[model samples]
Target: NFILFKTISSCLFFFFFFRSYGGKILVFPFDGSHWVNMEVLLQALHSRGHNITVVRNSKSWYIKENSTYYNIITVPVERGIDQEFITNTTSGIMEFERGALPLTSFLHLTVTIFHIMIEVHKIFIDFVLAMLNDPDFLKMLKYSNFDLVLTDPSWGGGAIFAKYLNLPLVYNVRWILAKEAHFSLAPSPVSHIPITGTGYTDKMTFLQRVKNMMFYLLAQIHYYLMITQTYQQLCEKTLGPNIDFNELSLSADLWLMRVDFVFEYPRPTMPNFVYMGGFQCTPAKPLPQHLEDFVQSSGEHGVILMSMGTFVSALPADMTNEIAAAFAKLPQKVIWRHKGDRPANLGNNTLLVDWMPQNDLLGHPKMKLFVAHGGTNGLQEALYHGIPVVGIPLFFDQYDNLMRLKERGGAQILTLSTVDKENNFLKAVEEVLNEPSYRMNMQRLSRLHRDQPMKPLDNALFWMEFVMRHKGAAHLRTESYRMPWYSYYSVDVGLFLFGVFLLVVTTVFILMRCLYRTVCKPKVKQE
Candidate 1:
C-alpha cells in the first residue's frame, strides 16, 4: 500500500511539473514533404506538453485545417504551391530528363526550377504581407506571448515573421532559400564541398572541381537575384529599412539540420547547427493483421518496398510498364506505392497500393530491398533499417541523395533516362540482391546511425526546450552572418596589410635613392 501511494505521488508530481513548464511554440511550416518531417517534430513537442500553434495557408497542400497535436491558424491565399503546380513541374522535368541533351537538359531544367521557386517565394511573401498588414492578426500574435517561432527556412516568411514579433527563431532545416542550409550557416569550400544538383562527391577531379565552382556561382546568382533582392525589399517595406533579408535568414537561434554524418559527407558546420537525421524513424510498430498475413505468406522470399516519396504519384505509362516488368522477374514479393492506371505488365507477385506504411515495412524482418526515388527522409529511413536501395532518381536533389548512398556502397542509381531502356532496372535490382556487400555496407551504416549517445529526436527536443529555457541561444550563433562578404572573408584585412607592405617598400626605396644621391654628389664634387 505504501509503495503504491509513492508511485501515485511521483506520477502526479511529474505531471504537474510538465504542465506548469510547457512552452507556447508558434510553428510556420513549409508544405508538402517538408511538412511530413516537421509534423514529426510537432508531435514530439506536443507529447512533452508544449502548446503548439501552427500557422498555415488556406491553399496549403499537406497541412490540414485540423490536427490532434497543434492548433491551426489559417491564412487565406488565392494560390499556392498546390498539387497541380507540383504535378505540372514534375511532368515538365520528366520530359526534359527523358529527351534533351545533357547540357541543354541541365540549362533548361535549372531555369524552369528557378522560375517555379521564384513564384513560390513571391506567393509566400504575399502571405506574410497579408498576415502583417492585418491588425487583428498582429494583435492576436502579440497577445499570444509565444516563446519562439519554429519554422522551415526553405521559405523566408517565417524568419521575417519571427523578427517582426521579436521572438526567438529556430529552423527545422535541410535547405535555406535556394541552397543547402550549410552554405548559409557554415564555411563551405567549393574545392571539397559539392554543390547540390551537381552530382559530384567531396573528392572531385580538377574538372569536376571547376564544375562545382560554376554550380556554386550559379546558385549564388540565383539567390541574390531571385531571393535576396525580393525578400530585402519586403523586409525594408514591412520591418524597417535597416533590416537585411540575408542576415535575417541566417539569424536563427538554432538550426535543427535534418542530416547527420552517417548520411552526409564530412564538412564544416556552425555551432548552432544540430544534426537530427532520422529523428522521424522509430522501431517498427506491429503491422496490421492483413499486412502481417501477407508478409508471412512470402515464406522464404522476403518483401521489397518501393515509394517515390510524397510527390510523383505515378510515372509515364511506358515507364510504369517497364518498372512493372522488372518487378515481375524478381522472386521477392513486392509492395509498391503507386497511383494512376495499373501497369499492363504488373505481376501477381507485386502488390500495388495507393499508400503503404513505408517505415514499418522497411523495419520488417523479411524486408530485403528498397526501390526509392531518393528523397532525404526515405534515404535516412533506409539507413536506419539497414535496407539496401535501388534508386531511380527523378528530379530535384534526388540524384544527389542517391549518389551519397551509392558512394557509401549501399545503393544503386538508375537514371530516369535509362530506367526503361536496355533492361537496366531489372539488372540493377538483381545486382543489389545477388551481391552481399550492399546489404553488409547498409547494415554497417544502420549500426553506426543507431549508435548515437542520444536519440536524434530527443536531442532535437532538448535543444528546442533549451532555447525556451534560455529565452534564446544567441551565444551559439556566430556574428559572421552580420558581416559584409569582404569582411567575413577578411578580404578587406588582406588588402590593408598589402597596402601597408607596399607603403614600407616605397618609403625604403625613396630613402635609398636620397642616400645614394647625397654620397654620389659629394664624390662627384671632389673629383
Candidate 2:
C-alpha cells in the first residue's frame, strides 16, 4: 500500500512539474490604479501554486497560502525620497517659487529667459546629486528579495530597482515606453507633446509622418533632457552612487505591454514582447440602476459620456463650450464629467458631476458613445464597454491615442486646436454619432480585442511564472544605455584611436626617411 501510494504521488508531481514550470512572482507597479490588472494576475497565478509578491514604490503587497486559496499580502514601505529638483516646490527652475511677474511683457520675457537658464543649471546639478544620494536604493533591494522584477516600463524606478538588485526585469508597457518597439504602446498617432498614442502605426501619409517625426524628435530631445531627468533623479534617489544608470538593463526579460497587434498601428514585432492591449481594461462591476435607467429612457438618441481624464482639467472655457454646444444640439443625453464652470443654462439633457464611478458608467448598455480627451485609460474603458468614441485630444499622449483609434476606424479624432470653432466641433461630433461604420468598426475591434487567445490577466500570469520557471529572461531585453550609441553602432573610440596612431606613424616615417636621405647621402659620398 505504501509503495503504491508513493508511485501515485510521484505521478501526480510529474504531471505538475514535468513540463518545466513554477516560481516566485514579484510585481512592482507605479501606482494603485496601475495595479488593477495586477491584482487579477496574482489571483490566477495563485491558483497554479506560484509564490507571489508586489512592491509598489516603497510598499510591499504579497499573497500567501490559504486552505483553499492563496492569501494576499501588503508590505508597507517606509523610506523617503532624498530629492531636490529645480522646481522643488513651484514652477520655477533652480528652487525658487517663481511664476512671477515684472509687471510688463518685455520684462517678463527677459526675466523668463534668465530664469530658464538658471533652471537648466540647477536641474543638472540637482539631478546629479539626487541620483547619487537616493535614500531608497538600499531599501528596494532589502524589500525586494526577488528572483525577478516586473515593472511598468514608464516607471523608471522599476527598471532602476531591478538593475540594482540584478533581478530579471520585465517591462509592462502601458503608455509609450518605446517608440519603435513593434507593439505601439502609446495613445496618439499625431505625436503631440507629452500626449501619447500612435505607437508604430501613425496613420499620416509619408509627408505627415515626416512632419510627425520632426515633432517626435523634438519631443524625444525634450523628454531625454527634461522629463527623463526627473525620472532619472527618482532612479538615483533609489539606485545610489555606485550603480551606473548609463549601463543599466532597459529591455525587460519580456515586455508585457497593454497592446493588441490586431488593433494597433502596424510596426515591428518581437516574440518576447507580449501585446496585452485590452488587458484587464474591464469594468470593476455593473452600473447603478438609476444610471442604467437614464440610458434606457433615451429611445432614438443614445447618451454620450464625456470625460477629459482625471489628471487634466478643462480650464479654458472655449473648448468646454464647443463640447457644450455640440451636446446642446444633440438629441442624445450627454453625461459630461463637467469639472468647474457650471453653465447656468446647460442643456437639460446634460448631467454635470465632479466625481463619478466612470468604469460603471461605461459598462452600462444604454451608453452610445464616449467623447474623450484621448487618454489611454479612458480609451480602454470605452473599448472595454464596446462604446464608440469621438476623441477631442487636449494634450499629452491623449493626442496619439485618439489618432490610433481613428486609424483603426473605431473612433474619430478632432484636434482641440479646431474644437473652438462651432462648425468644426459640431461636424466632428455629428460624424461620430451618425456614422454606422464607426460603431460597427468599434464592435469589430472589441471582438478582436476580446478574442485574444488568453486573457491579459492570464497572459501576465504566464509570463510571471515563465520567469520563475526558466530562471530570469534578462539577456532578452538589451539595455541600449549599457552600450553607447556609438559603441552599439561599432564606431569604436579605440578604432578612432588606432587610426590616429597609424596617421602619426606614417607622418613620422615619411619625415624620418626624408631626413635620413638628406643627412646621409652627402656624408657617404664625401667619405
Candidate 3:
C-alpha cells in the first residue's frame, strides 16, 4: 500500500510538470534597482518549473541559484564614464542646493542630458562587446534555444542580442517608460503626456505644453546625436549590418511597463503594451517584536519610516542635522534607515538602523506617514499600504514622482533648496498628519489600486505564457509599427490637401482679375 501511494504521488507530479511544457527563459537586466524589480518575477517563473538563465553584470545584486531551475552567467564589464559622470553631476547638483541657488537652467539641463546619453551609449557598446568577445558564452546562447527573452528596454544591447538569437523579445520596464520608448510603442500627445523630468500632468497650460514640446524635441536631437550611430555600429558588429535597434524594439512582442493609472495619469496605450505595476508588491508580513513594540509605544502620533533607498544613502551633515531636528520635534516615532553615523540630535521617539523592513513597517496599523526619496518601488509600496508621504526628492525622476503625488494630494514636497529646510520639513509633516484629506485620498486610491480583478503578477504570468504558447502573438501587434512616419502621422495627406487649396485659390483669383479687365474696365477703355 505504501508503494502504491508513493507511485501515485510520483505520477501526479510528472503529469502536472510534464504536461505544462516549461521552456528556457532568459533575462537581461542592467542595474541594481532593475535587478531587484526583476527578482520577484524571475522567482515566480522558476517556481513553476521553467529553467531561468540570467546574463548579469558583476555589480548587480546576487541571485541565488537552484540546481533544478536557475543559472547565472556573469559578464565582466567596466562602467567607466557613466560612474564618474553620475557621481560628479549629482554632487554638483547637491552643492547648488547647499548654496540655495537654482540647480540648472534649460541650456545646462539640455547639455547635461546630452552628455549622459553619450556616456550611456559608450557603456552600452562596451556591454555588447563584452558578451560578443566571449566565444563560449555566444556558443551557449546559440545552442540553448531559449523560448523567449525578457529584457530592459532602456538598454539597447538586449535588443541586439535578442535579434541575433532569433527569439521572441519581451520588454520588462522596471520604471515608467522613457519618452522615446513610449512614443515608439504608442501615441503620446505632448499636450497631455508629461515627460519624466518636466513634472507636468495630463492637464497642461499652453506654456507648459510648449515646454513639453521643447523637451521632446531636445530628446530627439540628443538621441540622434549621441545614440544612433553608436547603437547601429554595435548591432552591425553583433547581429549583421543595417539592423536598427529602435526598429527591433518596436517589434517586441510585449511591453510590460511598471505603471498603472493609480499612480500614473491616463494615457493612450496599445494592445501589446501591458500595465503590470505593483508586480513586486505583496501582502505585508507581521513586523518583528522589537519593531512592533517601538511603533505601538508611539500611541496616537504613530510611526513614520524614512529611507533613501540603496543608491543615495549618504547625506550632508548639515542637511542631516536639519532632518534630525524636525524628527526631534515630532511626537510621532521615527524609524530611519541610515548608513553613516547616527545623528547627534535624535530624540527619544526616533530609532536609527542600518537596515529596515520597509514594506512591513508601512503596512502597520500604527504607521502614519512616510519620508521617502521618491523611488518608484518605495512609493508604490507606500501607496499600496495607504500611507501618505512627506517627499524630499533629490535627483533623477524623483522630482516628477513627487510632483505626481502632490498633484494627487497624497504628498507634499520639501526640497533642500527651500529657504528654511527644517521649518519646511516640519510644516509638511504636520500638514500631512493633521489634514484628513491626504489620508482620505490615499485610502481611495489604494482601494482602487488593490481592487483589480487579477493581481499584477498573475496577469504578467498569463501574458508571458500566452506569448510563449502562441509563438510571439504577432496578431496583436499594431500596424503603426510597420508604417512610415509620414504615413502614420498623415503628413503626406495634409500636404496634398494644402496643395489643392492653394490651386483653387489661385484659379479663383485669376478668373476674378480676368473679369475685371474684360467687363469692369470697359467704360475706361471706351473713354
lDDT of 3 at 153: 74
Q: Between candidates 1 and 2, name the one with more favorable lDDT.
A: 1
TM-score of each: 0.97, 0.67, 0.89
Full-model lDDT for every candidate: 0.92, 0.60, 0.78
Which is the leading candidate under lDDT?
1
Model 1 CA deviation exceeding 4 Å by range: 1-19
Tens-digit lDDT string for candidate 2 (206-235): 665665676566545644554344545555
**After superposition, candidate 3 runs with Cα above 4 Å error:** 1-19, 61-69, 80-89, 97-100, 103-106, 174-180, 419-422, 482-484, 504-527
Per-residue lDDT of model 3, residues 1-527, tens digit only: 99999999999998896557787888877564666678778888887777889886654444443334568887787763333455566666666555653545445655665666677667767877888899999999999989999887777777777788888888887432235356666898888998767878788999999989987876666655654657767776677676765576678888887878899888888888788877888878988889988989999889988998756655777778778888899899999988767778878888998888888898889899999988888888888888998888876678788887789989988776772453887888889999999888888878989999999888888788788878797887887867777988899999999999999999999999999889978889789
Q: On residues 27-85, what C-alpha lDDT tens digit does candidate 1 reach at each position? A: 99999899999999999999998999999988988998989999999988877889988
**Candidate 2 vs 3: which has more lDDT:** 3
Once model 2 is optimally superposed onto the true structure by TM-score, how far is the C-alpha of residue 431 displaced, in angstroms?
Answer: 2.1
